[model samples]
Target chain A: MNMVVCIKQVPDSAQIRVHPVTNTIMRQGVPTIINPYDLHALEAAMALRDRLGGTVTVLTMGPPMAATALRKALGHGADRGILLSDRFFAGADTLATSYALTSAIQKIGESRPVDIVFTGKQTIDGDTAQVGPGIARRMGLNQLTYVSAIPTIDQEAGEITVHRRAEGGVQVLKTKLPCLITMLEATNVLRRGSLPDMLRAERAEVETWNAEAAGVEDIGKCGMKGSPTKVSKVFAPSPRAEKAKMVEGDTAEAKARVAIDALAETDPQLLSVIARQPALAS
Target chain B: KSKELPEHLKAYKNVWVFVELEHGRVHPVSWELLTEGRKLAAALNVDLAGVVLGPSGEGTDSAVAEAFHYGADRVYLVEDPLLENYRTDPFTKAMTDLVNTHKPEVLLLGASTLGRDLAGAVATTLATGLTADCTELAIDPNRNMAATRPTFGGSLLCTIMTQQARPQMATVRPRVMAMGEPDRSRSGEVVRERLDMVEEDIVTKVLDFIPDADSNQAQLAFADIVVAGGLGLQKPENIKLVKDLAAVLGAEYGCSRPLIQKGWMTADRQIGQTGKTIRPRLYIAAGISGAIQHRVGSEGADQILAINIDPNAPIFDFAHHGIVGDALEILPALTEAFRQRLAVDRLAG
Candidate 1:
């Protein structure tokens, strides 16, 4: 029943802005937090552990400062935190990231077998949602993604049933144990840490693993070398030239009337279409 | 300039688009990819093909025929009952098997829920690189595909290339590409492949599918008119104003990502890059600031009317019409105005 939750530290996107004149990213002074979607994954893992009486291990691959994110996870009820950090692991894309994380998970499984692996559906910064499936494929585990709910888990039978979000509907899927799951966001509320959990979080030592210690067999596959995808250029989106034709009025009511008139005038059929829907007109 | 094609990947040829068919309906994004894939295939001097995997039925056959109509020179078909429900195991295996058997130089898929899930697994199984949610796709001098997508929270765009990977893969979000007009006279060869795996080998089973009830879900993608609210609405209750306006016009109502993240609206009602790409005839965005992510989704609207208190809001830059006032106040007024206008027209008619 042991679960491993992978989280990442990302810059608070709300605070991230582009320079007006230079059009360069203004990243300075922004604080880093565990990816918002990962919080839902962490909460899902903790809930399962709380109900099943097992351990939840928080894992992350980032710089040394990323230990803070792991500590935050510990405070939020993760039993242990592991940080996979090394200079060789820098500039890794989702492929290389999954390689390093999968190796670290294998090393963790050497002590206690991992029954399930949890990750967010996608990171706000990367937004790829590829790494989790990459790890699952490499590790030969079932990949369950966009999971909205875990309604039942049968440890004895080695099965888990989940509600997955599809294009037009929800799919109730049942899979075997040892599956990797990427949780959809806002499925459950994150729980607050108790006094004892915070105290323990402060005292707990975060395990830091280098590439070799994490059993990375190939150094070339650990970072940029292993990444097949390369970014050729980064640029800001070009803005459109046409500005909105603003409707002026002293009051909101007048403005509304002007806007409606403008829309109807611009597209004469709009009024007729609205009137045609009798249920809407009344 | 682009790096030379690696010696091992030199044999890879043709461009393939995964034709996503479910419940006997082909997802529009699949056809859109075929349109774009035709250009890429022409640029590379290779054939454009469509890959259809579904149960043995008329659905799969029609998909193959439609692929030809939409500019595909050939169609790859793998029909099996196991491929029906889109389990990750069977779909990934089928796709990876196809790629290994018939090496495609470039593969395109829709950035839908099913496509994203399947692409990730298939790419990983094949140990190839994949670019997700690509906004642009092109072939360079070296014949390598360049996939450009939004990065860093849509504040910037990054062009990614899978330089060393064979069968370079990318997923384009729906509505990002133009759908090609189907030519009924067009025809193509269908190559049928068999999925070796059986039902027992696939660990995951689709226990049930609960289709979204008509009343409970917002059909934003096909709506002719849409009214969306944002954080500028100030409170959850203010959303009633947006619903009222939409009701008057017989339009769908949606909201920006923040409202969905804040639990004020359902995910289906979210209009943005990560949510839904809507191409409504008229879109009224109240209180939205038009971030690049949101713009990518709603820019296809024929007319965009932005309402916000800030004249400097980014939404104004792209909106066809705008009003500088609080949406909280203006939305109710607009609702009343539209209601009266429609009522008078109804009476006259």
Candidate 2:
């Protein structure tokens, strides 16, 4: 089985800072990490490869610096890393992104047909769980999104069963191979790299593919030209006239009393929830 | 604007909202999407239509009727046995084929799991633009639908517009939009369609559905009083303080996104842009740094009480009331005080 896992490099949110005056994200010096959700996908893929006897290839579409992300994956037992980087892929929205990724995956399959494709439920930067389904649609693969568990897979039979997270429950579904899965975050923990894999990550060369080399047949469909959605304006949410009033007290108990008193004046409904009494006093 | 489209694209005529019917019940977000669809359609002077697709008896008929009650001028119905369950292949094909047949100027769906799954597939199949998790939608002066959503990890909001795409597409955040009163007397025309695909062609099958136990699921989104702790609580064990306070007040307790990432809390208990958008009457946030992402989800609360060790924490900026103190200590103190106060109030009253 050949499994391809899609990952992205996103700014570490914990380290992200907002501008004091402008209230916009100050991203200049922030370091990037492989998207947290993607780690679950990578782990799921690697776990399957470990059990099912196959290779796990980590793939990413980003700038040249994105090779660092692939190396991170390689450090975590990935058999290979492929970077799809090109100026033509810049400013691509979900549609063009899926197309570009599908093109690269197809090219990868030229050597060995991919049995399963994996992606995180969504990227923190975009928070749009569209690209995975988009890729599945373009590649004619069955889409299993928000998958929590892959209980069974029969490689020769080309059959698989998964537990998918729906709105209110888990849908235990059976599907065929050559499918795309968007792994839900927190379903599995990423493994720490072994010493051998960690050393290999430093020495291994990541294969970087440009648009043409990645078999992008149409240049127009790779970037902004292919993306119909355009960002018209970016702005900060307007703040209220006054900031939160500092409720102060000499002690924590006083502070709680003051805050509670203030909340009573502002939202009596909430106050009643806590202290509402029956008509027993009457 | 519809007139300017080339001959092939000119048929796109009305605004369509996908009514999410699953397991014989309608998601609250479906009604919310229709609420916004009405406004968008009125702004563009187009009909507000609902696309309700499911099995014949499993809430499909009721969904069609409710669509009109929720302000849909017409309802497009597609009932098939294969549609009883939401399989990506059949749902996407049916939705895409319908969109191609009856061109809609703007299409909206809830950003729920099912809606996102189907919308992404259909939008890609149709080769159109789709803005996900939109918090705002409006009509541009050029008559295109302008969709606004949080971007750059929720620090900034961006307005997206589909240029030259016949049917502008967007998925709205579930609780952001206000749902209006439904008029029971409302009636509308129903357009019927069929899912031509068959089970034999489908690659996936639903073997069974296991519902999450209600006792385990957190009802944080609709909680009237919510108390959530953040990283300032130091570690997972300290979460007990938050629970103690919530227990006293009989409130649902949640945590920030980082806790979920850290495995300290379940995903359902997270309050942030990526998690549930809570509309509680009063929300008490403890030790939270108040990232813009967290702010987006909690800002809708009628009143916010923030407690943090750092006076400059951004949570204080938007919170209605602030206490610059350690939540670890303050939470326990607040709990004790509130307990005594309630007891005293009850005895006096």
Which pairs, if any, clash in model 1?
none
* Residue B328 of model 2, lDDT score: 87
The local lDDT score (0 to 100) that residue A28 gets in candidate 2 is 87
Per-residue error for B15 in candidate 2, Å, reads 1.4
Taking the tens digit of each residue's C-alpha lDDT, what string does model 1 give over B1-349?
4467778788889999999999888999999999999999999988999999999888888888999999999999999999888888888888888999999989999988899998888887777789989989999887889999987767777789998888899998887787879999999889889999988899999999988766656778877888999999989998999988888888989999999979998878888877888887789999999987788789888889999889999999889999999898898999898888777877887
**Which 10 successive residues of model 1 chain B have the least lDDT summed?**
B210-219
For residues A1-282, could you state the per-residue lDDT of candidate 1 as single tens digits? 799999999998643666777766677898899999899999999999889989999999999999999999999989999999999999898889999999999999999899999999999888899998899988988889999999999999999999999878889999999999999987999999988999999888999999999999999987888887887776777777889999999999899889989998889888886665434545
Candidate 2, A123: how far from true, in Å? Answer: 1.2
lDDT of 2 by residue, B190-268 (tens): 9998889889989899999998877558888867788999999998999999999988777889999888878898888
Q: What range of 10 consecutive residues in model 1 chain A has the weakest lDDT sum?
A: A273-282
lDDT of 1 at B111: 86
Measured with DockQ on alpha carbons, how good is candidate 2?
A: 0.54
